[model samples]
Target: MRSKQEYMEKAEELIYKTYNRFPVVFDHGDGVFLYDTDGKEYLDFAAGIAVMGLGYHDKEFDDALKSQVEKLLHTSNLFYNVPAVEAGELILKASDMDKVFFTNSGTEAIEGALKIARRYAYNKDKSHDHEIIAMNHSFHGRSLGALSVTGNDHYQEPFKPLIPGIRFAEYNDLDSVKALMNDRTCAVIMETIQGEGGIYPATEEFLKGVRKLCDEHDALLILDEIQCGMGRTGTMFAWQKYGVKPDVMTAAKALGNGVPIGAFLAHGKAATAMSPGDHGTTYGGNPFVTAAAAKVLELFEKRKIVDHVKEVGDYLWEQTEALSQKYKIITAHRGLGLIQGLELSVPAAPLVKDALLNERLVIISAGANVIRFVPPLIISREHVDAMLIKLETVLKKHS
Candidate 1:
């Protein structure tokens, strides 16, 4: 087997320099832990950026994927497939949405939702351009259309002349959203809990007010649940906790556990926006991917994953709050369920690196100073306690 250094050198030579990767090369994962090439074990708190909800090396997830591989893989959109159909049904039932359009990734899901909102407005009247209201410090995706809606200037500036007709509003600020709405506004999109920007969950009052504004302005409410949905926040969808339903919602990441799959769901009038050939994907919702997604949904119910998350998440937060009190570098901590963050007085990149190299704990940073903890839904309190010990050790060394 190749050494980690050799693999890292090859990756730097062949792959795009898109990510500032860690030094370790992961070999495999089981439950909430990952093993490196040298067989060093590290507890995984990032969960592949909140995608591996079922954790790693689960028998059920593995069996479902292998079963689909033996039966069929791709049939294209021209033919009907049982796995895709079942997955769609599950999504609809879970979201209470009328229609579902599957995509290959979260960004594509956002793109599809944006298209549906625009087409719905065009179906009404195409006299003028329709605008979408997105939130400041929000992250939708990297695609052109999704990037246009993302409110971060750091991600948007380099990709100039992106899709126009998109406006930005302050997150959790209902008045900012209301001010952006007008006759030309077709949709208002945001993450129920802002992920990459920081672990900031929207207030119930703010979401309810935004929903009312969307209704009054004839704009569809779109929730980007790519990072926070699928039981990451102790709910099937984060919006459900606020008692607000978006006209459209995008989901991915944990939707398929580790398989590549995404979906955009629409309700009521937004459901009928796209007709026959308005939009489509060649490999979206293929049997292989949808089978994994279907199995994930089933496992979520059978394991009572949402309830598990609520329990472990509460314990994790309480520990984190205590850590904040102990460590002077920790300024604040915030989040819901497994999606939580610890804001530091200093830049968090160094701390994240230290955690991996010194403490053998895997985690990621949100924005500049927040250490985001998005562990798998199946993590127990024991895992949380282990992580806290390692984290505290690292913080003390730094202090």
Candidate 2:
């Protein structure tokens, strides 16, 4: 194996400079611990940006993937595949939605949802509905369709002239959304818990209000659960906590527990938009990815993963609040389940760096000043205690 520095330099020369990567090169991992080529170990709290729900090298998950790979991989969507059907059914049963369309990533799922929403309107009166209302400070995905619905001007500025008929509303503010929605609106897409927007969760009242607005206007309610769903929010889905239902829901991230898979689900009228040959993909809904997702869902059922997330998530929230009160450097703390953010008095980048380098604890920074903590759903109480110790030490040093 090559040295970490040499490998990184080589990667820099070959790959695009899209990501400013950390200096560590992980060789392998198990549970919450990752070992680098230099024999250095780090406790991972970020969990690969909330993708690894069961943690690294989970035995049952690995076995399921390997078994499915050996049996079947891909056979194109021209023919039906068992894994696809199984995964889709599992997701439908898990969610309130009735049907599902698989995709390769979260952005693709968002794109599919957008298409369904638009097409549903087009099929309706054929003249009145086309616009989609998204929230300010929302992060859906990076694809053009998802980008168009995303609220940030900074991300949208470079990719000028995106999909038309998209409007912005203030997140968690019912009045802002009410002002923008009209007869032309086909959908209102938002995250139940905004992940990339600094872990902001929609208030229960706001979600219920939006649900009513969409119902009244006959617009599809599309919830983007890419980062906050699949047991990350203690429930199997975040919308369950909000006490409102969406006509269409997009999910990815932890659906396959690190394997690339995404899905868009719809209920009732929204499901009728797509007929055969209307939309399809070569790699989407392939056996390999769907197999992984099937196993993930299976584990979710067999292991009671949601309960684990609930216990650990509550512990994390309590500890974060305690830290906020003790340090006074932390301006605020907010979130549900494992999706948490600590708003610091100063920039959190230095603290994140210190956590990695000095404390050997891995964390991520959301926005500029908020430190994000999205550990694996299966993370133990012991792991949380360990992380709390390191976090306290790091915050004290920074203060």
Candidate 3:
């Protein structure tokens, strides 16, 4: 009963088979490392799918949560709570957006953003036939609403008859977007940096062009930053790098630094479109989660996390580039700041397995061949160096 295998077997019997999860049964985490039930330490590069930006067991973050738990937890959105208001204010300030709606998860945030676009159009034109243009090879979320706009055929095929008006366009290709977009297009949704589709970053020119197109068509530009936001891209949000502001931006993952919070921030027409009946959430802006989010945001500012990302991200990119040079199996390295990926000539799954079981290093795979590196933002140069050595051992075996 104490063994990892026993726990995993029990989980397999009880849990749904939706995920092909790894065999590692993690019991706890501290700083940038996770310890399995067997107490095998792993240098964490995945960071709980980019959720643990500040790393595990951060004293300040944990203490804030502890305090909030004692003071208040759920007052619900039925009435006002201090943390919700404070978190909303901080999110709006960070994003420079006029309004925000909190959600329980990133999927909900995407759902909210899509509704904002649709409702905004409806308010102006009284039209139900509005189309949403999303990028090809992009990942949004698993909800029906989020899935409707997710542009991958594999993920969308089983769930057909999705929201009727979502169109797919090529990422970083303005012409492809131009070809699909028209007057009825109410929103152009995209990941600020495509994560699961092999870690591609949007080129400055393409993002700027999309902004122009949205402006011309009077369509809201919804940037899904669930994976790329929260200082992963050397800015509070990835679009800030190019000075292109989205009408509506969806955020999650690192937003609460592991406390499960998501938000959609909007400005101008999109902000005004949502009335009380248009959207609502019972547990979305509860005192507990919003307190975690507010504290996370406050810590981000105090720690100068954005500036730290810039410095370390440069170092990470350099080290990855060096590894690419050394290992001919690597075809390309793509991404910005901390969210880097290495596309290998061979399948990445085996190497990832080897990294975990043999090297005791945690990394993730994306789009079949890309090895994703989204370590905790709190990781130092020494942590990256450690990850490199362990990863190199696996790479050497695989290559």
Candidate 4:
């Protein structure tokens, strides 16, 4: 293979420029660390945007994938597969939802979720004149339908003529949601912890109020758990923290541990919203990915991932809060458990770059100035200390 820089140039020449990707070309990963092509090891705090929960090069996860690959890769969604059935059962049990439909990515799952809401409302009133309430600064997905519900104007501006009837509301303000919500509202969609929107977990009172509004209006409550689910927030799902159950929930990222798989779960009146012909996917719920998901779920139950997250997450909170006091650059801290952020007085991007280049630490930015820390779910206090060392070195230089 060529050098990392050469590979990057090849990619830039071939692939369409969507993401302003980082500089390094990661060759592989082991445990909580990622190694670049040049053999530099970096502490991984981003976890591939909260997807690699079990961490890199996990033996059991790799074995599960190899076993599935040797047996069957895919048979399309036309035929029912055993792994799909097993995974679907596990997902339903974990989510406590009645039905589920798998997709290849979180964005596609959001699309399915939007369809579920609209179809359910149309079934009741025989009208497509329904609106969805999304939160400001919320990031769902980049697809047309999902982008419509996403509250970022920068992402949605160029993609004008998006799907109509979508309204933006404040993240934790129930009154703003109520202001846009009415009889025409079909669903209220939000990230349970607002992952890409600066790691703001909704207040319990606000979540309960939204649930009440949905109940009053007969609208489904859709929670996007794509980034914050699968034990990222010290719970199986962030919404579980508040006890405000969603009528519909979208999950992905760590569901397959690294394999591409996403699902939108539904319950109560929203469960039977979509019939057989309503939604379909080519490779979703196939033997390959579902087997991976089943193994991940089984490991979650067997290993007690959530309890571990809570312990280490509390430690992370204590440590970071202490750092916030020590450093003037840190204005504040937000979030719960592993999905946390430090509100920086300086811009987060340059510090992120400095951490990557100087300290070989991997972190990402949420919004403009908040440094986001979404480490692997399997991270320990030692990993947290490693991250803090690298991060403080970079932050001190910035200060």
The candidate with the higher lDDT, 1 or 2, is 1
* lDDT measured at residue 263 in model 3 versus the true structure, 0 to 100: 95
Per-residue alpha-carbon lDDT of candidate 1 for residues 227-260, written as tens digits (9 for 90 to 100): 9999988889999888899999999999999999
- For residues 1-399, write the lDDT of model 3, one tens digit per residue: 468888889989999999998998999999999999887899999999999999999999999999999999897787999999999989899999999889999999999999999899998899899999998899999989999988898899998889899899999999999999898999999998999999999999999999999999999999999999999999999999989999999999999888889999998878898888888988998999999999999999999999999999999999989999999999999989999999999999999999999999999998899999999998888888999999899989888
TM-scores of the models, in the order given: 0.99, 0.98, 0.99, 0.99
Winner on lDDT between 2 and 4 is 4
* C-alpha RMSD by candidate, in order: 0.8, 1.1, 0.8, 0.8
User: What would the per-residue lDDT of candidate 2 be over residues 152-199, giving only the tens digit for each residue?
Assistant: 988899998999889999999999999998889999999999888888
- CA lDDT of every candidate: 0.93, 0.91, 0.93, 0.92
Full-model lDDT, candidate 2: 0.91
What is the alpha-carbon RMSD of candidate 2 to the true structure?
Answer: 1.1
CA lDDT for candidate 4: 0.92
Clashing pairs in 2: none
| Between candidates 1 and 2, the TM-score winner | 1
Candidate structures ordered by lDDT, highest first: 1, 3, 4, 2
Error of 4 at 40 (Å): 0.9
Error of 1 at 328 (Å): 1.7
